[model samples]
Target: MVAPFPASFLLGLPVRGSRGERGRRPARCGPLRPPPGAQGSCSQRCGDQSGPCSCHPTCFGLASCCADIRDFCLEISPYSGSMMGGKDFVVQNLNWPNPTDSVICSFKDSIQTRGHVDASGRVHCVSPLLYESGRIPFTLSMDNGRSFPRSGTWLSVHPSKVSDSEKSQLVNETHWQYYGTPGTQGNLTLTWNTSALPSDAVTIELWGYEETGEASRGPSAAGVKPPTPAGSLEMGERRFQYDSGQQCCYTADGTQLLTADSTGGSTPDRGHDWGSPPYRVPPRVPGLSHWIYDVISFYHCCLWAPECFRYMNRRPSSDCRSYRPPRLASAFGDPHFVTFDGTNFTFNGRGEYVLLDAALTDLRVQVRTQTRTGSEGSQDRGTGLTAVAIQEANSDVVEVRLGEGAGVLQVLLNQEVLSFAEQSWMDLKGMFLSVAAGDRVSVMLTSEAGLEISLQGPFLSVAVLLPEKFLTHTRGLLGTLNNNPADDFTLRSGEVLPPSASSRELFQFGADCKGPPAGGEGGTALGRARWRPAAVFPGAVQNASSLLTYDSKFLAWGWWPWLGSATGSYAAGRATHMWNPGTWYPSFSSRVPCSVTEDPNPEL
Candidate 1:
């Protein structure tokens, strides 16, 4: 009846069967659809009675080419499978070589799966499906109205029947599911079981449904698993701290100059006590050495000491009178009139006086006196008179008067009096005085019984206070001196001299004295126009030379010539002997010139 199956057929070769048994026999492969306009198609034909058709060249033939007619092909309805064919059934398996067809459903990027048929006849043909949402659709194909095997579909598994092995797999993989069954259209929905999944799991998985008849296939057939849901369980948040790099600031030590806040005072008002013994002049006349005269000429003595002619007998010209005075000066005296050999001044008579011309702001005067009991009948007997007065030239009235009485000294500032008890040494600070330019300061004994006042041996000293504003923009002495040292010499506080106090001669010794004796004048005749010879006792060359050399270099470099010594003058000659302080000498020549000797016997 079967026409006697060919021997090849008995040996397991493909053979054509009757049309009625075509459903039971393996279907022959048909020609594959050609690509659009390709002008070609698969060479083999189906249902051919000729020799066995060579459809499968290799073990597994090329995958079926499903042409997507529309961009929305992936959105096909699971129930209708409308994208396939109008009959609700498509050629899922073409000439497939299998005893029973199995559906292989795979998901792309959605919850639904595309139905496929695996020709291998393995029940476990469907691969694992991944879903972002908990709801998943498992699709299958029906065979001519026959229901699929209930044991092999996702719909067949009950929650209570889930095996321990499946439960373990779900827990280890952090996956969960809710079993679902196929509807009238063979479309099933599998919902993720939230109870079985960890709280951080954003997606759920429906691993291939392992029905009773399904074969166990490894992950090689499983599709790519979907990544965890985009925004779920962020692995804790990250935080950081930033720096701006400007946290701290500092400066090197000693770089900052002293400030008023740190010094506790706004002005440089440090005071000093002359406790050291007085320096003595050598027995030989100072400036007599040859080196002294040479250095003096080298520096042009007239430029520093215009009054040098008084002792040198040099020409007195405009050059000598036009010289500028030093910024600071100390008190000096003559040997005969008022002998102040550095320590003290000896006032021998009423005619003797010590005169100083300075733009003084604050003047501090210290004096020592010894009074001898004198005859009551003498002209200066009962009252010992020692006085210090400040006045203008040719003035009848004094601006300030300080005098010694019987047991105290009275200060009369424009007739207003401040008295202090007389002691062996008196320290008087005269502040807020209005001494101005061209003012004359005289220290004298107006009347003397047998009283002797000593202004030498540090017994008499004066400290001149500069204006407070002098250092307004100056950081230190360096700034003030580098600029004009004599910039502002006006007193910060002082009373102006009244016009009535002016006279033709600003200074006079006693009531009867017309003027100072020719050589008895205790001050430089050129007044502020001449520099005050630094009071350097013959033996004080070391200290004086050091100060002079320093001031000279400062002036030469165009800096303000500031000699910090409490008592000294800047001598230009010292600039030459800078390397040797011991050999340096005063600029003045000690030997009296013939011209000076001829004029008068001058006071030393």
Candidate 2:
């Protein structure tokens, strides 16, 4: 039994007990005050009572009135109300480093959720403050700081135990270090293998505390500085911008491409671990979370490949010179080999070709080219393929073919149109399409007396999937095409001629023809061409509302770009769409009243 102090105290006091021990009341002795310097005069609580109590255990305001001679005492107080002893001591503030701050692991490759990241290079923290004290007892809690259990050595965070907030936010807990006592200075080191992270995005949260000495108290819990992050992960925030025409989201600071998946009628998913079985973004229509193609002009037409040309007739005219204004096709071709979206197709010479007739204030066109190739037999029959042809007004079609042509051919139609003599054949094989608006197309090609053919390119937003290293030329091409101002291409002898004699002319059935110098007006060079579909940005919140409205003289249009909020601002520029001509320029703003510019839709 523990030692008992001298007591001038009163016992034999009567106390009350609850029915069936449901509620036990405490017994209290009459008030007893010790004189100054009296030994063991400490007034402490005794007996097991429920709810609030001071030094002495009592039920409500009534002290125990028990009349027993034995003095009952409290064995252990889980939550102590007061400090013991008459001496005062101060616990030093340890100023320890937070264990969570230094804990991080960025996976160089995608990590599968719950997949064990081998202990090699995984983040681990050992508190110097705790070790310096030799043996400081501590507890660990996986369910945050709510509860703790005794722990020695190290703590591990399995990806499976990741909470909804952590998973949704892509956060991971590699390890944490803690200090058990106050007044000790300490530091923690965290290290992780970034190559082991499951997803590209991640976040982490950590917390720790030190117990004050018997007589000391630190600052309130609210004033604590959070853990400092370690490794390559930064501590800033991220933002995004939406290009409606491209149907994709771009990082604001770096303009990096971001992938999106539609979730049909529900919110689209982001930040899911890539290694999860059959992981995918939400389907653009419903429960699906993956997309085969992102941007499809009209229906299946893609923008990543060479821009195909289609001839449209405003009216049925026997003369090819009386052509219609240009417009984009409603269909597109997928590029791959062996049923994997092949990159090549057979050419036909009989398809219709159109002329602007008059120069365009806006040079954008909506040309309808057959995006899909027909069966092998149909290719020979010219069912869905055709050649791009042109004819000059009042010129002999046959004479121009033999180099004995005479007449002023139509040149530069907005800096991209090609000039042609009546009935002359121009080879379009292996040519890259590029376009620049606001120039005289007829004059741009007038200097090339040797059958000037221009590369008229159509612009469409697309995502490049090749390895990062291979994207150099592709990225340069895109940058030059998009208002880079300093870009120019010049053709050299025999440099850009079509690959084979059969591919040289639009009509393989026609007579032999040695192609002329492959350069248009202004010395524009032709490069090899390849085609692929464009990627579209998935909606942030699906089918939010209609962004476009139409009627008579008054039309209403919204600036919603798939996943963007109604209040975002985008830089002003030309916009592209399948049903409209290439010249359409639609402007949008988040806060300003919707004011209509020239109707961007082409005359379909």
Candidate 3:
């Protein structure tokens, strides 16, 4: 304890002193500490220069703590600018605590402004001059006492009156007015006062004002009229006429039905009266029977001798009813003409064959002839003659073979037999042939005993097949009740009867029941009757049950009369709603209603 030591070893340690002497404390080892009067924690003062204390050595030398506070506040305060006369000035620099701190300024008892500082420490502040009152009391604060010179102070400034000229300039610079003039069409001529605007302004814009009142009310505003109901005719002012001269038939309901005339006439005629008897020309052929001749010649030359047949030289008959019309003349002359006697004939002569044209594709052939027995004194009954026509490269030929009592006429196509017949006449339809134009056709005939063959009245004809037409029958029992020819009814493709009227008798059945309600107003009632038992009991049930009652009378008169009524009622009830009315009936409301009602008060 008495040994001496270096001063460095005792620098940080407490030293012992002699009796009646004070002990000396060691010097602090860490960096210099801030003055006792410094505001805020040590870490805060060290990091933030704008804090209450700068914590710098130079600032610490100040004699008064308030001096340092004053200096810090001035350094961070926003720079001020000269104030213009008669205008409010804004001071935006005060830094306040975030979130919870606010800046409150009191210029006078009646002039106090308070606002919060943003996160960025920018103060939302404004100061107005009060020069008329001379010195004005001004006090600024962040919150509570966190402000320099935490007390009210007086600031001196003169407030001058705003001049009339200056006020006019400000009014002109701040506001704009627009003038509108009505123009042609729907356009408006708009002009604005640009004299008050600044010279540097480049563009001016116009805006339209939205209407806040109720919309206009009228029929046009309501909506467009609905479309015409389906299955109903919409003949507006147009007129139609039916030609009686033209062959036409009308249904019991007066709806005209159209048909094609088989005769060579431009006017349409009644289809049923077309093929009546006692005519020179056949119903199937209108003019010359070239098709029939060509068909006969084709068969003759292609099937038998391609060299013997020849075209017939004939003329129209004076009377069609007396003998076969000239139209029935054979393409390969009559058998007697070809055979001379009934045994032999020539072949391959010049102008001897008719040419088959390729333009004929689908063909229909009708032939009428009665078979007869051959020559007498023979035991064999004569079969129909066999005629053949063959086409050859150099010359066409015709071959005739005597039959051995075969009565049936056998038809062959390309060496293949198709059909055989023994009737007086044959009607062949849907015949497809492949003969080319300019192809030679010939004919020859044979029989067991030289039999005689004669052509019947208008016996033969040929024509091309046309496209099939689909005819729809729309006749209904109710159609017979009304037969007014003036009331026109047209059939359009794809039109179908409404379900309500499908089985029910139409109103046209009797005058007692009114026609279908005008303009679809009461049609729904009829549709409802189709399903409602109560509605059916009035008339519909009776109409439907009448047939059953009539039939039941024959079986057992009044034995089960109630059964029919019960069934009718049950059917009506079951059928109600069974069919969808929308699918069966037509709708008139094709357009949506417009919404023009204005709400006086709407939710914000």
Q: Candidate 1 — what's its lDDT?
A: 0.22
**Number of the top TM-score candidate:** 1
Tens-place lDDT per residue, model 1, 1-604, is 0111111111111111111112453233344432233221122221111221111111012121222111101112211211111111223223333433334343322222223333343122222312111112343332421432111112111112222222222222111111121222232323333343324334322222110111112211111111232323111111211101111112355233222222211111111111000100111111111112222342343333444343233321112244433222233221122111111222222221223322222221212111233457334211122333343222212222223333333334332232222111211122112221212233321110011222332123332222233223221111122233332111112222222322211111111112222342213232212222222111111221111111123222211111211123444423322212322212212111110001011121
Q: lDDT tens string, model 3, 1-604?
A: 0111111111111111112112221122224334345454322132122444342222323211222333122221211111111222223323333334445555554555553344444444344322121123355554432552322323222111222222222122112111121221232332333342223343322211111111122111111111222232211121112111133345579654432221111222211121111111211111111222233333343333343223211211122144321111122322111111111121111101111111122111111111233466442221121333232222212122212243322233322232111111111111112211212111211100011122221111111111111012111111101122211111122233232331122221110111223332123442323222211111111121111111111212122122222354434322332221222111113110110111112211
Pick the winner on lDDT between candidates 2 and 3.
Answer: 3
C-alpha TM-score for every candidate? 0.17, 0.14, 0.16
Candidate 3: worst 10 consecutive residues by lDDT? 590-599
In model 1, the worst 10-residue window by lDDT is 275-284
Q: What ranges in model 2 sit over 4 Å off?
A: 1-228, 231-327, 331-380, 383-604
> Residues 287-347, candidate 2, lDDT per residue (tens digit)?
1111212212111221222321211111111322444322111111121101011122233
> Which lDDT values do the candidates have, in the order given?
0.22, 0.19, 0.23
Query: Model 3 segments beyond 4 Å from truth?
Result: 1-68, 71-94, 108-110, 129-137, 144-156, 159-604
Error of 2 at 35 (Å): 99
When 1 and 2 are scored with TM-score, the better candidate is 1
